[model samples]
Target: MMENVVIRTVSRLAVPFIQIFALYVIVHGASGAGGGFQGGVVFAASFILMIIAFGTANVRRRIDNRGIMWLSVIGITIYAGIGFLALLMAGNFLEYAAIEAVLGIPHLHGILIDLVEAGIGIAVMAAMVSIIYDISGNGEESS
Candidate 1:
């Protein structure tokens, strides 16, 4: 584990900013550059930073295997739920137009799209963290 106070302090300070920027990227991705995948990757980087500073044990304590599983499930559920809802509304899978029409809300498509992106971001982040943990071979599973 990195014992350097400077590096640990810097990582601790930068982690939140990195995560916030990741969310920004995910949100802004709808109209311009950046998107779910990028933002998810950025969010995963926060955990990576933590691992680098404190080691896998710390990361595991914060997010165990079960926690990772829940995150993945929740993320996928969010995405699939939105898609199935659109289907229920008699539109194609993931068709936001039908949702917009049914919801009768002005400017809802963008928001729904953002929600989907958020789900994607969450899923990707979880997957990446899991992969990192696995690759690191950080002893046995915590849970």
Candidate 2:
């Protein structure tokens, strides 16, 4: 899939903007249609660009499978932890209001939620890239 020139070029060109947009989406999720899942996939596209451009070896060197796995786990943990914290505060799971209370600024609830979504995005991107790299066999294994 990454072999196509069009895919490679588009992915490369769109990488940065996609990432930025992803952040925007995650942050504005409460007010908009985007969220953690959408942003994470967008974030992962950057790495996908790297893999397509330089091959799997380069991507692997920059981000190994083990590291990606840990990252994914950590991301999930963070998301869950945040939800738990909200629950502990007597709010529904993942309730941004609880987070706002903790931060002492109710208005910042959206910001905090966005942060968590970003984390999830990071994790998803890592996991997806890792899977793609693994399947790609780290590029042509130099002679």
Candidate 3:
């Protein structure tokens, strides 16, 4: 963990902005450049930043292994649920348009696409954080 006050303060302040930017990247991906995978890496970057500034144990208090696994599960469920829903509606998996067709809701296609991206972002972020935590070792403060 970083002991420098300046670095710790700066990182603390920057984490929120980093997360917002990641969300922007994910949302904007629906229309133009950037997407789930990219945004996910960005989101995970914030947690990585936290680990650098605050250390694993500190971050873990906020989000532990169980929480990470739950996040992964929720994200995967969102993605797969949408795909299966489409399939049940007589369309190929992940066919966002089929949902719109069946529900007759205009503009649902874009929404569904965005949802899938959100799920991807969540899952990716969780996975990345999990890996980093594991690789960072047992969070013991080395003298």
RMSD of each: 1.3, 4.2, 3.0
- Model 3, span 102-126: residue lDDT tens: 9999999899999999999999999
How does residue 84 of candidate 2 score in lDDT? 88
What TM-score does model 2 achieve against the real structure?
0.75
Best by TM-score: 1
lDDT digits (tens) for residues 1-143 of candidate 2? 54678877876788788778878877776677988888777777777777777677767787777788888988888888888888988789989797677668757776667668867877777778766766778355322
Better of 1 and 2 by TM-score: 1
Clashing pairs in 3: none
Clashes of each: 0, 1, 0
Clashing pairs in 2: 40-121
Candidate lDDT scores, in order, read 0.91, 0.75, 0.90
Task: List the candidates' TM-scores in order.
Answer: 0.94, 0.75, 0.94
Please state the error at residue 119 of candidate 2 in Å.
Answer: 2.3
Which candidate has the top score in lDDT?
Answer: 1
